[model samples]
Target: MASHLLLMRHAKSSWDDSGLSDHERPLNKRGRRASGLVARTLVARGYAPDVIWSSDAARTLETAKRLIRIIPGAQTVHHNPALYHASANTMLTIMQRESEPGGRLMIMAHNPGMAELYNLITGHYHRFPTGACAVFKRIGKAPWHDPQSWRVVDMVLPRDLEAE
Candidate 1:
């Protein structure tokens, strides 16, 4: 059976608190709003994931919380410190290692890793802005690690949604 893979960058984060480390910074006001909008859009489009893998950073966790609240279909979210600013290979390895066999999976993380992953899978350059998601459809019984097995289905960007 086919499954869905969603790679999303965390929403815009606050740099207001200069004292706070990058990992400790939370989402900004615009980010919070964008998070809700993206979550709602995902549900409306029937793209909600069965499970979520997210970076343990404050922004990513906050984004995940917003998604969970809006999309009740997601089973659970696993936060991993290793995912924080991870490279594309690292993200792919962790995803393959932690993912369930056959179900929709979402990764809430940071870039340029997110963008790199999208490029690696689709063989095309894609801008993965904050609060943006790239949806891929995994063909039947294909390995998640195989780029040939997945096809880009959609690119959901907060900017486009905001303009609507």
Candidate 2:
């Protein structure tokens, strides 16, 4: 069976509070709604990530927590500091370190890294807008799946769900 992966960019964060550190920034009103939109979309599609790796930053943490509630099968979400502002290579390394083979994984993270990771996997460079979800199905052997071996099944953007 192919391993499923969802790359989620953190929801919109507040920039109004200059006093708050980037790590402490939380989701804005729009962000909260967007998060819920993504969650509902996942539930509607009957997709629940079995394992999750999320950035320790407040916004990502909130997104992960909120997103999982709609997934009946979702359990633990591993919050790691390294994921906060990880680079493309760093994110790839984190995925490689997973002990569970063929387990569906979800990563809630920040911009450039998320976009870079997606581009690395898809060979298509594009900025990941806030609240965007990129779904990938990895086919064939464990530790063997590369960019070419992965198929992008869906991409859900926050705006795409605005009509809902």
Candidate 3:
């Protein structure tokens, strides 16, 4: 079965103060704008997902919500605490286990892991900035286990949205 995975990095966050926990940090104004633009771009590109999984962090959740707003459906968006600061291996495991048969999956989470996961899946280094997204097309009959089976379909960053 063919499947597509969209991995997104959480939008820019506010760090004006140091007291807040990492999970509690909210998206800054620029983050909000960039996320909206990306959401619109996804809609325009017909990249809506059947399932959405996101980190429990405030910024990540907010980014997912904004993306959902553009899609407009009754799909449930899962908030997984494990995704908050998960490693690439952890993220891959989650994706492999949770992905539905022949369905698109979208995940919103944090850095190094996101970049690492992209590289692992596509076999190419991908620098994921805030609000960046990488789309992978999986063609194997089995689930998303081997990274070599996935192909990088598209990748976009917030700066790329400026040209759209």
Candidate 4:
């Protein structure tokens, strides 16, 4: 069975705030608004997944919570420490390990890795801005692996949602 992966970057975060590490920063007002829009879009598009995985960072966790609130009764949300600042390969490894039989997965993470994963799977350059989302569909396989096996279905930036 083919599985789908929805990779989302956490919404905007506070950089002006003092005394907060990159991982400790929380989402700002715009970030919260963006997340709400993303969540509504996902719900409108029927993108709810069997699992919602996110980085342990404050911002990512908060984004995941907001998403879940919009998608009530969704599968449990997990905060994986390994996802914090993880590379594309690391994220892939996590996906490969966590995927269940005929299950769908969504990942809420930061940039660089999210962009890298999108690029790796789609074989195209993608600048995933904050609150951007890339949807991938695995073809002809069950377990998620090998970037070549996934195909990009859609890439939506926060601006795209705003435009709609």
Number of the predicted model whose TM-score against the real structure is largest:
1
Stretches of candidate 1 off by over 4 Å are 99-101
Supply the TM-score for candidate 1: 0.95
Which parts of model 4 are misplaced by more than 4 Å? Answer: 99-102
Q: Using alpha carbons, what is the TM-score of model 2?
A: 0.92
Whose lDDT is higher: candidate 2's or candidate 4's? 2
Q: List the residue pairs that clash in candidate 1.
A: none
Q: lDDT tens digits, residues 16-127, model 3?
A: 7699998899999999998888878777776766678899999999988888887756176899999988889998788677745446678889988999888877777867
Q: Candidate 1, residues 91-116: lDDT per residue as tens digits? A: 87886676354577888999999999
Question: How many residue-pair clashes does candidate 1 contain?
Answer: 0
lDDT of 4 by residue, 51-157 (tens): 78889999999988888888866777888999998889999898678645355678888878998888888878989899988877888654467787678887767
Per-model lDDT:
0.88, 0.84, 0.82, 0.82
Worst 10 residues of 4 by lDDT: 95-104
Which regions of candidate 2 deviate over 4 angstroms? 142-145
Q: Rank the candidates by lDDT, best first.
A: 1, 2, 4, 3
Q: What lDDT tens digits, residue by residue, belong to model 2 across residues 1-164?
A: 43788889999998989999999999999999999889888778755577678999999999898888767778788999999989888887776675654457788899899999899988897779999999888776646335565678889899989976
TM-score per candidate, chains pooled:
0.95, 0.92, 0.91, 0.92
Model 3 is weakest, by summed lDDT over 10 consecutive residues, at: 95-104
